[model samples]
Target: MQTRSLWEHTLTFFPQFLAALKEHAPRDATVAVIGASDGKFVLPLAAAGYRVIAVERDPLALHGGEVHLPGTAHAHATGLIDRLRLEDLYDRVQVVEQDFLGSEPLDRLCDAVWTSCSWHYSVNHRRPLAEFVARMQLLVRADGLFGAEFMMPVEARHHLVDHYTSPEKLSRHFTGAWNVLLTLRTAEFTERAHHGRLQDHTHRMGLLLAARTSDHPHPHGKKNA
Candidate 1:
């Protein structure tokens, strides 16, 4: 398990992301987690019966062998599964140990794609962020959604986790019928130095949930007002 600080800067508004998913995707649908570190959301989602594909490159980080990054504990979705007696649920989940950008095109297999504060690392590696995002957009089914929580950067990104995203840039990158469903920017998010050896840091970060539509949906029954 890990401290809640990473979460504080990550998916603080997970419920909203769920609401957006429920509206666009269906029950037991297959979803791919881009950074799918140790199943933070993947485990819970799987327990709920949704088929989850957790994609991670690092052996240690994904299922927790050793914490590569000193300031944080890594994903251990496997541990969570056994501890919770979720071995039966294993059939519904797949752990793909591969680099996100280099993976084969998973055209239209997933009903949705998700990640929590993990996009920055992949996007930075791609360079020219929009191009990378466009490639990622290929994975989702047309009726499906892509939901994520990104930490907005305070200054130049010194580290992968430091890379942040904003609603404006996200909106710009995603053209066509899309919705920036939720955007929350909180300030003075103080993170005390873990051991008092490092200086505490405070800055602004944004949580964004966006979904793409088929340009225009035939105005049908019950609009999710």
Candidate 2:
């Protein structure tokens, strides 16, 4: 049986991003997945012949372990690494176990980078949204793809946090050497209860796909024109 992620059923714009990546990046390109949970996106990238860097911090999410299921149920869930091995894709993926924000720079720049609804978690809110975006951006090589699907403001509290943002607002960060390729947003929608969230909830999501047009120095490092 194919191993599935806890978020397998969640709505996402990842398919669109993947299609774009295939068009822009070479078949053998290296792609990095930020907050890669249980190999959802990582597996597909690897299976498509792309070398993947899977960055995830949660032990249970990275390596197999028993866990509580939806309600009053428990199961031994297959984690990202085991899943990759199961499908013979392990060789194509390098699992990096660390908190993405606090982790040191990746060993090498990637041809493309993607993150899905990762930075909106309560734990991540402590850091400014710009930090999360800048970190993801830094991982991409020049002329590479940068894709992120984020939670837009839904709850009253969400409105107060900049991390819960729309595509238009998020696009501001992709200036200078970056070119915005696509921006998409979803209307408020209901999602069924899942592992971590045991109650059904409503959410709005936004996707921003951009490409680095040139290798420009970091804003702070740039010399005066």
lDDT of each: 0.60, 0.88
Model 1, range 1-225, lDDT digits (tens) per residue?
232222222325566767777777888778787776555677667777788887777664454343323365543223433422344556777777777767764533577777676656644555555655665566665566777666677766633442466767666766675656667767757765532224566656566666767665422321221
Q: Once model 2 is optimally superposed onto the true structure by TM-score, how far is the C-alpha of residue 188 displaced, in angstroms?
A: 0.5
Residue-wise C-alpha lDDT for candidate 2, range 73-176, written one tens digit per residue: 78888999899989999999999999988878675677899999999988898899999999888888777899999999988998999999999999999999
lDDT of 1: 0.60
Best by lDDT: 2
- In model 2, the runs with Cα more than 4 Å from the true position are 215-225
**Model 1 ranges with Cα > 4 A deviation:** 1-11, 68-88, 156-163, 192-200, 215-225
- TM for candidate 1 is 0.73
- Weakest 10 consecutive residues, lDDT, candidate 1? 1-10
**Residue 173 shift from truth in candidate 1, angstroms:** 1.4
On the 0 to 100 scale, the lDDT of residue 53 in model 2 is 90
